[model samples]
Target chain A: MPGHGAAYFGKLAFGLVVMFAILAGLQAAPRRSRKIIIAFFTFLGGLYFALEFFYPAPSGENFLTGYQPLVAGLGAVIGSFAIGLGVFSLVQLHLRTLSRLRPGWGYSIVLLVSFVAMTVFGLMNEYSPNATVIPTVGGLWQSQNAHGMFRFLFSGGLSNLGSATFSIIAFYIASAAYRAFRLRSIEATLLMAAALIVMVGSVSFGTALTAGIHPKLTDGSENPWANLRIENIAQWLLMEVNTPAQRGILFGLTLGLLATSLRYWLSLERGAYFDKEL
Target chain B: MQHASENWWVSGLVVLLSLIIIGKVLSAQRGRVPFIRRIPGLNAIDEAVGRATEMGRPVMMVPGISGLDVVTLQALSIFSYVARAVARFGNKSIMATIDPIVTGVAEETLRDAYADAGRPELFEEGDVRYLTGQQFAFATGVAGILIREKVAASFLFGAFYAESLIFAEVGQQVGAIQVAGTTQTNQIPFLIAACDYVVIGDEFYAASAYLSRDPTLLGSIVGQDYCKLLLLGIILIGIISTSLLTLIHGGPVAHLLHTLVDFLKVK
Candidate 1:
């Protein structure tokens, strides 16, 4: 047998050759043939990871370590490239719209411009490790050094924007809760009650509000309810009621995911996954 | 691990089975394929699109910040269906995405839906916009769109994290009728708090099948449930056997049970 490195290189070359041949064949094939090939690749690409993960490896004296993982990684890489190809196609289509000066093509122009700008900045930053930047303005991103520039763009600018965007949800939650939590029916009432308890139990003030309420039977600190800690109640709910229910939901989700994956892997999924013949 | 069977044969089998199923579906399309019942959350699609049209407002569709993963693809499928409806209604649909790849797919889906509806003229390429890939950047962009566009209805579906609350909240703030779904358990509470209708966990997967009423898809879903039952049985067996082994005196059965449990446990 050849050495491991030689074998690995030989295999890689063979794979690359096969891929190129398939691509060439796909290009030459008729429409139906192409579609079938695409579907075949899609199925292989989709389920390879799940199979490696969920299906147990055969037990033997000597372990087969590298092969399954390599296959899984290659499958993932190919699948990812397929998605990338789709994105590239989309960008190309939009670029064509801008070139043709299609109506409302200005938006396409903005998109292309932003996309190109981000790509350039991102790539340049990646390639140039020790580039220097001079501080210009705003306390937020004034630093001119390379590290400073990276921090400004990735951490300061991107992170803050993300955080600020997410923070608004707090206001929206209050509003939604106000509208949705009305005691309109029995189920609604129960839901609202649960919501109220959970929400109150999560906050610090809620603990203080209930802290003075003494347990009926005990005065010792060892008493479960004596401290009347809201956080404690919340933890109890999460650990006792919430964990099991969540686990059950998770159990159902795992099965659903597995089944869906299996059907796809086995080529049994119909409807949305399978395109209807036009 | 890497047998020719693992590479070519497994792939071939998967392809063959899938093609056979697809062929069966196509052949069966001629006759009355048994009707699959509509899921209630899916029933709201028409109403949601119609609400936007009647109000002359845009519909906000956020396909989570997840990348071009399976969950995101599932979200895109639903978005395509919804976009088609909006196109038919002559209503606007706004899609905000974190992944450039997903943005690309969503745009294609929207454009295709419009083209399919014979209203390609109504499609706005920029309507399917790329927000930043950063978790919060996408969330904020969605929130801004919700607030600025005064969206009549919001559809937030896909993989999400803490940003789920942010998106749903923005929809709520705009007073938009919201329908949210995701597989993320951590984000479900946030969605439940803010969205009008929620499809949690596997329900999200069932959305397209429910809306389309395709029996083949419904059968796949039932098949999925059966698989879940199998998983449940496995879990029960594992737990019971492990427990019994721990309780009983040492024996070959006990040793076997211990081995099984140990093998299954991940470090």
Candidate 2:
């Protein structure tokens, strides 16, 4: 038998050769042939997942279930390659902007610098020794390593920036709610009432508002008919009123999903993507 | 993880519904265009594109931050139609996608749309962008584009989460003609609140059919309605049976209701 290293290299070379051959064949094929091939593979892939989901097994394990890990690994590999494409697209756009020196080119430069710094530090963080393995420096310089750089950039910079961006949504939601809650119509008035009830019911102030309304009862028996509490009313509104509406919407959404999926599975979906010649 | 044995009824129902849809599609292919109600949100796509053309401003289309899925694919189909409309009127369209796979597909769809409009040269590589895979990062990037481009029209379709309002509100602030649609029921209210036109519920999925006027899609939409009617019947039966069982306090009706509930149960 060949050495382990030699065997590994042989397998790697075989995989590369197969990949290149497939790529070449795809490139050489006619557009119609390519489409047919794609459709056939799409059908096969969809069928596999569908069967895996629906097929019964006495042991609660099917043929496809046994290969689920392999399938997932394949998906991860594809996703990783797609990430590379995403990065390439980002770099291409920002580089073009910087070269052209557009009005907001400075922002593009900042984006590129951030991207490079984050990527380098993130890779270093992944490959570096754990915090336990690395010696702790004294004073505020305890983590002066690659992992620290990544943590600062990721947690301190990117995460905070993301949080700041998300915080902007509070203002937007307020504005949207303000506009939406305008008492221009009966519907708006009803919505406002519901919103007010829900908002009031969610906080401690809501309990205080109802505390004075209810008389103190000497018996420890719970009053089943007590719907006067804002919290209870809110819960009833959500569970009774909101739930039904949501269910109605969900029913429609699922039927729609089924229809669309059927269209795609049957290759009946026609448009630029389907009918147009490659 | 109920297998087919445990959930055979669901599988059977799904198969039956799929067959019905396929049959309808086949019938539609024979030149029978099914009648569909006027979907105002879909109707507004043309108006949005027209306004963009008249203003000489770009149109912005975001297919949400979802990876490649049925929702994203449906969004892309609508994007194709929008791109074609923009191409016809010599207007630019910018598609900001969060997924690289979606970006590649959107690029191809845009190119095809331009070619179909007989203006392939107008399709720009930079127009179809992959902003970021991160959710909030994608939202921020799209918001930046909406503000900077001063887009005349904004189209939001596909799966959206918390960022739905951010896009809709920003578009509203920009005073753009915003048409939004998503299968996410949670985001529907936000879109309705902030957008000029909001396609609710299944209407988001029917967008391609409504926009394209393709017979196959229209027929499928009709079949979907049929399945919905069937579901309505089932729900009515369930309600009636349960009410009768409660009122009668245990009888044959109760047994039937119990059986129906058991049959429909997932596990």
* Per-model CA lDDT versus the true structure: 0.69, 0.85
Q: Compose the digit string of candidate 1's lDDT tens values, residues B161-262.
A: 877877777676677888988888887877877777888777887776676566655555554554556556767877888789769768888888887777
Give the per-residue lDDT of model 1 (tens digit) for A1-278: 32346788898788778877877888899866775776787777665544553344444212334456776686565655455655565477678778898765776677577567555556556666356556556666554655555665667766776677666667766776776688888977987876677789888787777877666545455665554566666777778888987887776665455445554554444433345541
**TM-score for the A-chain in each candidate structure:** 0.64, 0.82
- Model 1: DockQ against the native? 0.26
Q: Which pairs clash in model 2?
A: none
Docking class of 1: acceptable
Per-residue lDDT of model 2, residues A1-278, tens digit only: 32347788898688668866886998899989888787777777778788987887778888778888887776675666677877898899989999999878998998999998888777667655253324566764554677777888889987888898889988998999999999999999999999899999999998678865454345866665457788888898899999999898898889889888877765777785567452
* Cα RMSD of predicted structure 2: 3.7
